[model samples]
Target: MTTHQLTEAQKKQWEEDGYLVIPSFFDKQETKEMLDEAKRLCDEFDVDGHPMTTFKTAADGEHVGDEYFLESGDKIRYFLEPTSLSPATPDTPSRLLVPPSQSINKIGHALAILNPVFRKHTLESDKIRSVAKSLGAQESPRVLQSMIICKQPRIGGVVPCHNDSTFLYTDPPSAIGAWVALEECTPENGCLSFLPGSHKLSRTATRFVRAPGGGTTFIDVPGVEPNEEKWDDMDGWREAPCSPGTLVLIHGSVMHRSPPNPSDKTRIIYTFHMIEGGKGVKYDEKNWLQPTEAMPFPVLF
Candidate 1:
């Protein structure tokens, strides 16, 4: 079996292109464990007294933020599938079309520290930490965001093309996404597609930050306001298909998106972002997720 350390070829690919799809990064047992755990989380989640917020994305880059979203940084929170709900009236919220177990779009933000299973496979593994060091995380890499993106079956939730640094920002924009496939991901089932070398276009990205008055707003990135033109592709966009255990290391600035899962199979994935943390790196306060002293970002050792 190959070790988890980045090979010379993998390093060269990352250096030149800012993205890599490393096959079999995890073993079968490891992949199976995570998939089963994600299903268990979805099955055991209770809907009583919980907010039924649906995750929605716009073609134009505008994002909708609520208190439930803003406060989820330090906690494990569930977001409902936008397609799994009925239209809302004045008083009542959107009603769920499916049962609670199958209605979640994702569980996110703090799973690496809050959940033992994720923590073990994530922060606690020597192989994972070794990989982090190879990625230039310096002596310490602070992981603040971890997610189980459950591309729910058949509802057709599609994420528009966007980068990760827009949400998790640093001064020089240092965020690396560690995306592991828990099940087979195919183009037909909304697997990730990438515009390779897009990260080198601009280290500085347009951020989606918290607005002072209320809600969220886009700022800093030198460009026009939210519109379809921003999402227009120039060419060289390609789909990346993966089997179980494949790990795709994505540059925070690389433009990537997934189509709707028209097939019955769910394209579930486990992903987390690690940003450079130290004196030189500055994590902005205006970013969507803020780390309190009580729940500081977990460092990989």
Candidate 2:
């Protein structure tokens, strides 16, 4: 393999497992910069007059699909952790049980575009460019969205089984996720788990898109569903735990999820998704997350 391209072994892993976990991909300095910046963002964010909405996944067939979430496609927005909310009383509705800083689930959707630090480290980095160019997943790859997931303490929430294509869709369904660990991820702290080789066997993954009436919802893409036998069997699932700087490149159709963090440590991660933005590729206007005039998708070399 050329210095600018991924190794032959890495490409092999991508074909076989549908994901590649590269140890220390981001290096110590970069990881420290990302982690420190994320912590600062969480610490300084003002919650005044803001709705303390918790981020939820459809692990239960429901999630927060409010206007705040929908409009945040081109902006950085805070989402609270589901397990951090205080119980609601008759008069008062549910609220954050702890400090807002500790309760945040993520700051998402446009970090790579809007945040200077993330933009510098992510889109502008030569390493990122080389990696993206190496994968060659899309004819013209466009970075769509980015986030810093604060899997906070014992209150971190579970992300249900799903695919990147389900969240960031394009015609011919091009979506690849670049995920980096900013802090150590372990089984106790909710490291990622993948249904290895599921991308090849599973047909079309579910699509999360704008509902016709209003808000957002999940609709199945027209294809055969995953085999129930494979879904039920936990023996084949691959648990991926990593040190602070590992990067995981995930294919669009890979079925993956993370369990809730029962440990006291936070498992922080930074991730962004890329999709096809070439002339013939179609990005639907009705997608729940839409690019604005100000922050439209930019093609990566």
> Candidate 1, residues 1-301: lDDT per residue as tens digits?
2336787888888877778998888889989999999999999889887778767677776565888888888999998888888888998777789988788988988999898889988888877888877866456778878989988889858898888887788877788899999999999889999877777674454687889987788787564233333433658887899999998998887888899998989889999988888778889878878888899998775
Best by TM-score: 2
- Candidate 1: global Cα-lDDT? 0.83
- lDDT by residue (1-301, candidate 2, tens digit) is 1124689889888989999998888779989999999999999878786787778786656878888898998889998887788777899978777898898999988999889889977778778888888876777788877999989988898888877777787777778999999999999999999988888876554678888888788787666464454453556888999999898999988889999998989998999988888888788876788988887887676
Instruction: Please list the Cα RMSD from the true structure of every candidate, rounded to 1 decimal place.
Output: 2.6, 2.2
Misplaced by over 4 Å in model 1 are 1-3, 137-139, 203-205, 221-231
